[model samples]
Target: MKIGLLPLGRPTFDVPFAEEKLAAMLAALDATGHEIVGPRELLFDEAATRAAMAGLARAGIDQLLILQVTFTDASMAVAAAAGFDQPLSIWAVPEPRLGGRLRLNAFCGLNLASHALGLNGRAFSWLYADPGDDIAGDLKALLAGERPAGRLDAVPVATRSPDGARVAEALRGQKIARIGEHPVGFDTCAYTPEAVQALAGVSVDALALDDLFDTARTVPAEAAAEVRRAAEADVTGLDAVNQEELDRSLRLKAALETIRESGSYNAFAIRCWPETFTQYGGAVCGPTAMLGEGQVPCACEADVYGALTQLVLLEAAQAPVFLTDLVDMDAADNTGVVWHCGQAPISMRDDTAEATATVHTNRKQPLLYQFPLKPGPVTFLRISQAFGAPKMILSFGEMLRRPMAFTGTSGVVRFERPAGAVLADIIACGLEHHMALAYGDHRATLRAVAAELGLPLLEI
Candidate 1:
């Protein structure tokens, strides 16, 4: 079979690591004795991807396999699926838990690609494995036109929480300020205002990313200093990073508070990405953590539904909630690692570790919170659009006492079920990558809330 391989990546991540992994992957594919067509180098943007796809189309490949080399938005994957008629598949490599940086966030790219393709009504197969692993069987299955399908289980019955009515009432008048649009091909962040209103009685207010930047610029030095002083109580090493950038990051907190108070918004969904580091010269992760600790949930990547999910969990748990990604899972240890760049609330920091001001692993901008999560019972929740409709997804787990799995805010969690089973369910269900995590067992309250909202509950 002739296979077309398109390698996608972003410059923000570790390009050297991606190149090494790409070379290994190409060598493994060559061992299969299949005709491999397309560029071996990483395609960093749409133009490169489109140009490569044109060549693959001319080659008349039987399958198109996307080599997700690093954490990239789903635009290129979606475009490839739209342009190609052949069967599609994605292969994302895993990085070791080096306790430093996430060298290649390929799995996250695959997760994003899967969600976008599902939303676009495109069918595809997926594989998460390292190049050195023996994946001949998996490769054969993909060549035989195999695809992963999520199995929907019956909603579980549980006792409703007495606070369900109050939580429902609280959601009625709440509003979320969505600053800027979600990144390209981030279908998981896509949401309909009417649906949100109907289900949660919440309103969404769209704002430009520049508006936040402008407000941040206007923040007086005194106000920023006040924020910095307040941060010193919970955070350490403020002066270790670039002082100018640190001041800029603190100003972002002041600016967000201004917008939140003036707009009467209960939450924020921010496009906290390339611009925050590339254009604004600071990171918003630290500011997001501060606001979240103050009960104003902030979702990254302008994920509106993620903010709403945080709100729901916050109401249910009545505590600080962290929106995180399930980065790594190990069946042998029955543990899965939940992590984010650096936006977890300071209150969730482990007792043994001090919350330190840090830089983004990839972007290298200051003002991100770095610490392991506290060990305790936890509840995971998401307002999911998987399967093309909104539903309630819940999971119960316990954060184990362990060393930090990787850089930024991360925790090792043991779910109610086996790690392998949970991983399989997550992939099969095509769940969104972001999950709202609140420390403590609030499963009952979440169930009651889901019941009150008449949303289907899928507990994995």
Candidate 2:
């Protein structure tokens, strides 16, 4: 990627020193294979800044990294660049002094520049570093267009759409496991294993439920006790079939451990299928949910690609994450319903389950859930393809605080466009309707991966 570094204004101190710092920053960036535009001054005067921006735009640069805002008065130049709507990153550096009384007030100027850029409603990233730390990675990652900060930087975006078709195609060579068979004859959750292999280049392996059972049988008594305690605290009716459910759930965890121990799979999808429903006569949501949270990608749809997508996302971020279906949607208030067999990992919960989660064990049957979800802020996202394009839907807000309360929380999301319009833009390009929902904002890194894999992106 070619990055245009336009010096917004003249230096407040020595011009040569300013040039030297800019050169150092560029040199660091150059190592990463990104072409830097220059020490070119966009504005010696405010008016000149506007002219420089036009020139940069005409030159067709991918992004801009604004430098030395206090120097060379170019407020107009920054404003003009912002007008173009190119991705921007505002760099603020602390003055160099060997721990000598901390002289220059770098923050004051950076704050002013950030505010000016903010007025235009532009999204940008900020970094504070001296000559030492590796800032080029940050710059390239941003120029490539991913969130450059926080845990979200690691979340992966998988595409089965045209935008990411090549990526999905490349992914085909990879191997993954989907534990247990699809619920006997439940078709809704059925998947075409042949279609998955043909389309995604993935080799699928079906695991035995006995593996999970064996692991559960051998679990340390303490672990089983913890499971029971968690269940007792969170689920209702301990006497109403608590032991039965706990035994099954613990066994499921043990099975997951066995799968992990084998090391034959890069990722996994398990059927907490409905037989556990008829036989145990309770639910298996907690165990399956826990498996996903533990880092295995468990898909309720018995979808190989879906599990792979979740696995990719999980690899990007090491934090606890949930894999769920968009079970309900309310356009009236912009609220949606999301539920599954409740087998998501317990780590994904910031708090305890509000109520018990249940499901029939059929892998092909719709998961039945009755628990109120844990509460906290959440960022919802989906990565799927349409007409061959890879697209995403990312939004953030607090999960409903009250227990399974008020039919779930809903609100209007603020963005450059509406969800339908965004969806339209994505589908018009031919992306997939399937998406992997994550619980955090991962726009930046996901975008970067999309670009690397040659997929078009939508940022709503």
- Candidate 2 stretches with Cα past 4 Å from truth are 1-175, 181-203, 209-242, 264-266, 279-282, 344-377, 381-435, 458-460
Estimate, for each residue in 1-460, the C-alpha lDDT of model 2 and write its tens digit.
6676766544334455555665666566667787677445424555565566667787787777766533222254346545666667655454432211112233333433443333333456555445456566665565676633211111344543342333444464666677677543222233556755654456788767556555666777777777666555544554544455556665555556557667556566655544455443334456555556556666653555567666545544445556554322322334433434345455444354444433232232222234445555555544443222234444444445333421211112222344334322322222222345455555455454455544444554
Q: Best-fitting candidate, measured by TM-score?
A: 1
How does model 1 fare in lDDT?
0.88
Backbone clash tally for model 1?
A: 2
What local lDDT score does residue 75 receive in model 1, on the 0 to 100 scale?
Answer: 88
lDDT of every model, 2 decimals: 0.88, 0.48
RMSD of each: 1.7, 21.7
Q: CA shift at 32, candidate 1, in angstroms? A: 1.7
lDDT of 2: 0.48
How many residue pairs clash in all the candidates, one count each?
2, 52
